[model samples]
Target chain A: MSLPEDYLRYPLRRRGMDQDRYEWRPRADAPRRAWPNGAKVAACIVAPLEFHMLNPSGKPFKHPGAMQTPYPDLRHYTTRDYGVRVGAFRLLDALKRHRVRITFAVNAVLLTRAAPLIEAITADGHEIAAYGWDTDTLHWGGLVETEEAARVDKVRAAFAAAGLAPRAWLSPARSQSFATPDIVRAAGFDICLDWEMDNTPVAMRTAAGLLHCVPLSNELDDRKLLIDQRQTEEEWRAQILEANALLQSEHDRFGGQTLAFTLTPYVIGQPFRIWALDALLSALATDDAVWTATASELVEACA
Target chain B: MHADPNLYDYWPYRDRPRIAWPGGKKLAFWVAPNIEFYEFDPPANPSRPGWPRPAPDVVGYSQRDWGNRIGHWRLMELLDKYAIRGSISLSTALIDHHPEIIEACVARRWEFFSHGIYNTRYSYGMSEAQERAMIEDSIASVEKATGQRIRGYLAPALTHTERTFDLIAALDFWYTCDLFQDDQPQPLKTKSGKVVSMPYSLEVNDVITYGAMAMSPWRYADVLKRHFDQLLQEGERSGVVMCIPLHAYLVSQAHRIRPFEEALRHIASHADDVWFATAVEIAGFYREHCWDQTIADIDRRGLARPGVGFAP
Candidate 1:
């Protein structure tokens, strides 16, 4: 059995990355900048308020924290719904208590559907960034440029409709098509939080212009730690503190470091796990060297 | 289709041939840091797609890129502290994409072997000739880059056709890290020449343990210690091999590195008991010492009888 002649050929094999969306700028070579307060670490906390549809097509691939059961998965539906409903308030309270200005990555459908939730988040004086249309919605490579671009524009338009200007964007599950960066840049956004190539913000070489990529690290993410890994609350806090310690030390030796991570309401907002979030926020506050900033503040300082 | 591959004969892991490593070391240890390069977008094989999501796959692509830009240096420095020269499973195209990494690995005198052109590309539906050309291209790339011939193959993304083993044997590669049958290196039973299946473990592979299994760092560190202790104890009878196949992108994260370091420190403490070696070195030693006896043992055991017979 044989295949096409072009199968083994690598068309995009080049000196730098195979794609042109970004350059292969190593972290070692990147200039390290100080945060606004002369702090060594920029603590960027992102909280995604997503809504998983009851019936998912599960195209391309099933994302983490998606509905696991068959149709009418009320079990998982309510589990995730709890995040936007009851859990988000607990998560917000913790951030508000610490006086930390966090960014809320809201889905497009959630903008119109959950107006009260949107108003609550906005009224709390936190930055609201763009998440995708919904958890099931995807802007993947399988989608054509026009379709993907429309999705980005649709999300941007929804943000405008809500009377809230989105300075940042994070894709649902952080999935993207080849045309995502160009589309995202064309939408007139300042930064995207989907690419996590470094601890510091990077300028993606988008055709629209240079799009600042503020990397929200998935390493110590609350959902990954508490939900996926089945790690104990203590283990989760320890890992967060441990990762922060490492980044702080790296900042001291190198120049700039961002301790950026995502906190899910359904995951970390659970009563048991909420204590861990409280402990982590308190622990991070104790470190005067740590500078907690919103996504826009981070990109402005680093990118 | 044949029920079995027939490439390797079934040889039991009981009392057979006893191997003694160099300097009478009980265990042979090697670390394979897969210095891989996942293309932003590659030609898709009809049987299998490349990225989990669609093309571009900004998240998947950037995560791997982070390894080269950030993780590789961190891992390289840690390995240097332990005086461990990693036998890099390289995506040959990375020789062009990132030469600085290649230069650094060369400076440390690390062993280089072919892991195909790009990790994203697979060897699914290819003419034997085309596959051979791909293999030849990889060999040529490594030779040109490092001024050294590669002696091992772990196919790109571990995707392969049935003819892979024989082709690699014909190409005169010494060993393959693809197989996971035995804890020790064994004759791969190739048609052309001697090719050994080095015990490149999938069990404790960081990609499996960390990525697939979603194991926490604390647990992984403990697993490493226990895995090493057990292998060391087993090696008392005959020599055994313990390979840690790693993806720099996964393990080099700041959160995971400390736990990994603790495990490495535990393994490195047994300097006298372990023969810190590379894949090729282990395969070379196995070929020179254990190849003949192991092949004969397979013959003697009647485990691989030529004539087909039913169990009934």
Candidate 2:
């Protein structure tokens, strides 16, 4: 049997991006800027502090680290919480030893549940950015505008209620609807780190105005390397160092390059894996060419 | 569906028809750059939906879009550096969608073969006429744009009907990148008498490894080198085809591209044994040299079905 008549039709096929969220600039043409200290590369490490609900909605799709077993899934819930409880501090101390300040993308739910943890992160001179409602409430394309807006507002309200203002936004799982950029911008976020389209920063032309985007490295993250890819910690460190070296060379050729990697406590913060993070930081420390900046600093310097 | 389609017989790897590439090179290496376009929203196929998230999967869509905008140029320049002409597995609608990309690839003398009109379209439940029209449209679109006759077919998004092979063969295509049972080009039993299953690989494919397998860039680089080494070693016995199918969306990220470039550099360094040819050239050489012997070998091994003939 044949398909429907309209199946072959190409309605919106055209020159540039199908959506108008951002202008497409090729790598040679993508915007780049010099680092503050004449450094060739800027490393923006994302420290994600999240809360995974026991019973995940998983409406469209389940997040990578979302609960896997049946209800009362304490096994996964506590495993993820271990990031906030024990692992984050271990990595934080290691980061301090390397003398690098990072951006902590705090899920809005964590503002209340881990209030002292958030306070401690701020006290230690790390910047805070807004992650979505929790690890489970992802903003997807099918989500209704009003429903998505309400969720977006929850991030602001949760942090505002805590008398803290975070200017950057990263969607949970980095999933986004067509209107996510517009909504996030209208809600007054200066920077968003969802799109891993490029290593460089870009100012997305949303309906609400310009929202600066700093791409997070989806491939180089700890969950991707150590967990998903099932590579050893040694392999993970090697991959990160290789990525940094690649970017460093590109920086030498071009203007400047950004090497952003995510350090999740549940994944990279495990007692066995923390040394790998230490090794990575120690290696970057020796490289005087690298300027470790917060996500905001990256947006300011590159965007 | 039968247990096996019985398209190609159980032809063993060893002592087959010897395939000698140009310059007596043992390995015919090709870069299959899959230049595809996925629709933001399209009428869903009864077989498979267009996207995972409801309608407009913004992250997935824009990430692919980044390939056309940013990734392609980076990958193209790297290929140019190695003097490797990409045998592009093109989504021909991109000919209309982004002709600048076409012009650039054409300038490098790249070979364009049909992937399909849009990658979003699948060949799962089409009438015989619909599949023909879809295939022909890609041929015409690519022909009109670059003035190159596409000699090969890769099913759009690799979705196919049972009749896909027979249909493509009937339309006078020289090669199909759809099959992966062999590392060297082999014959497909088509009504047209001689249609080659060009040695396009899924394992070495960037989308499969980088996206699906979640491979780290350097790990991917290491795999590429390892894959090439194995093929080069095997090529001495019988000429082997090593195809590295790349998608700009996955392979050409800033951190990723450099390692891929190094892998290419490593592959290209084996100048004597590795003959860098397009899919069409590989097919043409096979037809000229290896087809009759291969058919005879298949018959000698009792692998042939009745009434199969090589178009001599």
Candidate 3:
């Protein structure tokens, strides 16, 4: 695989000053260096499942071109909602296997429909957070105009069914509604994952009150990773490893600053992709300093 | 189950739109000149000897090839008329393949937010290492093309996974326009630290509203003016921000160019109350006034604070 030629450049001009904040080591020593002794990093592993087909109603029925038509039952392509089901099952298994907690950033529509999955996430010592609903429609509609109460109810009901409550919510596709914090706060979420403003978590204003906004990223997302071409199994593994290294480096650099790694089952849920992810997780687990926790753990700790 | 009837009801929803701090009066318009191209190079698809053409799915066989569609000088002139500075969300490959389009964006002093190497390159299933390289490549392409440091990023079609947040933060972008959080800009949390989701509105975008449905220039201009009026009124009461995304190919089309022209005229008409600027400027203003505390909290909580890391 030919690496994009531009990847070698350092200290990019636009954000060079900012990039300098995270000191870069030569490639030779990059893998071995650990974050400073006192340093810490908060890592969030999120898997946003594409759960639309689950509803038995939402499917990509319309396409701009000759894309294969989706089956009425959604069996033609990956069952629209099947990914979410697998995601739910996988979260439960992963939690059990790793014996660590996690957070499921769910879109509202799927939250209600994917009841069993939501329950598994909560039962496995993880957190359930809002990921917005109807990604494409929501993206077009913008967050300002969403029905706050309805949104809150859908999310709350989903969590309540699972005998849990989500203290924080992330917008669909990381898109926010100006009133998102308000809806979240009014609905009782104490924090949000909406801000990409910084690397660390910080307090942010919501309509209801000041909620903690933990900085999140879109870099590790499958949608971004697999944009132009589908990634091979080996390439996928490398991406995860590189991310761990970066986070580990930052953890060592800061006096114990938190870092997050987010993912979506729809992107990584494929059996082949999952195998690569599992391997990456194995490597990460070897690093004793890397503690795997849920979104709530990180948010609550920081808060 | 069908979508809630109320869900489709944009009418009432419009009336009860959440009333919060003024959305913002300042406008940061992004004109993403998406360029796509295709060539039926001889010996097409060596596998199929005289195989009645190319694979519709693999190789682009769409209406307008990206190459011919982007970097239209005529469109830049329209933006210039209103003194509207913008961020060009360019596909990195498009910039590399066609430097002229890059020149057109640079000529107009537009900022370039990388939209990935190519429109078709799916980032899904990419490993952590490949993702890092792709991001670095994208950043480099943006800088090389626009001669401007890309401070922001927008995902392709906004399709993304969870790992993106930490990765983006690690990269240290000032802001990313990829998300649609709210009508106004606010600080959202990321893995590394707090970053602002400089709120972007596709409602006012040319792609869906106009490009999908044929909208007359005057009518489209009216729509923008009305939206602007709403944001402006709210801004007068509290700080608010407005963002409008445009496309070069769509708006540059002969039939639709008038709306772009008229929109510029309308903005020019209200220059004083409506601050015409880039996405960065609006985000900066919000960062200073409407969102300082939010950003700070994200920063404090986002970083590893020794014993303070991880929630119970």
Most TM-score-accurate candidate: 2
Regions of candidate 2 where Cα sits further than 4 Å from its true position: A1-303, B307-312
lDDT of 2 by residue, B28-121 (tens): 9999999999999978888678898888899999999999999999999999888999999999999888999999999999999999889999
Cα lDDT, model 2, residue B191: 68
Worst 10 residues of 1 chain B by lDDT: B303-312
Models 1 onward score TM values of 0.51, 0.52, 0.45
Candidate number that wins on DockQ, 1 or 3: 3
lDDT of candidate 1 over A61-177, digit per residue (tens):
776778663333333554566576546866777887777878999988878655666776777788899997888788798998988888888888988988978989898889998
Return whichever of 1 and 3 wins on TM-score.
1
Per-residue lDDT of model 3, residues B39-144, tens digit only: 2342332222211353443333333453255426666777777676666676677675677777876777777776666555545556778777888898887766
Candidates 1 onward: DockQ, in order? 0.01, 0.01, 0.02
Q: DockQ score for model 2, please?
A: 0.01
Better of 1 and 2 by lDDT: 2
Which runs of model 3 end up more than 4 angstroms from their true locations? A1-303, B1-63, B66-71, B211-218, B288-290, B295-312
Candidate 2: tens digits of C-alpha lDDT, residues A150-259: 99998898989988888899999889998899898888898998987777787889888998888788888889877776786788899888988888888856777888
State the lDDT of candidate 1 residue by residue for B1-312, as single tens digits.
222344455454445577889999999999999999998888888867889889989999999999999999999999999999999999999999999999999999899988998888888777789889888998999888888799998888777666777788899999998765456677776667789878776557898778765788987887678778867866787898999998889999999999999999999999999999988889889999888888788787525545321111
Candidate 1: docking tier: incorrect
Give per-residue lDDT, candidate 1, residue B164. 79
Structure candidate 2, residue pairs in collision: none
Candidates ranked, most accurate by lDDT first: 2, 1, 3
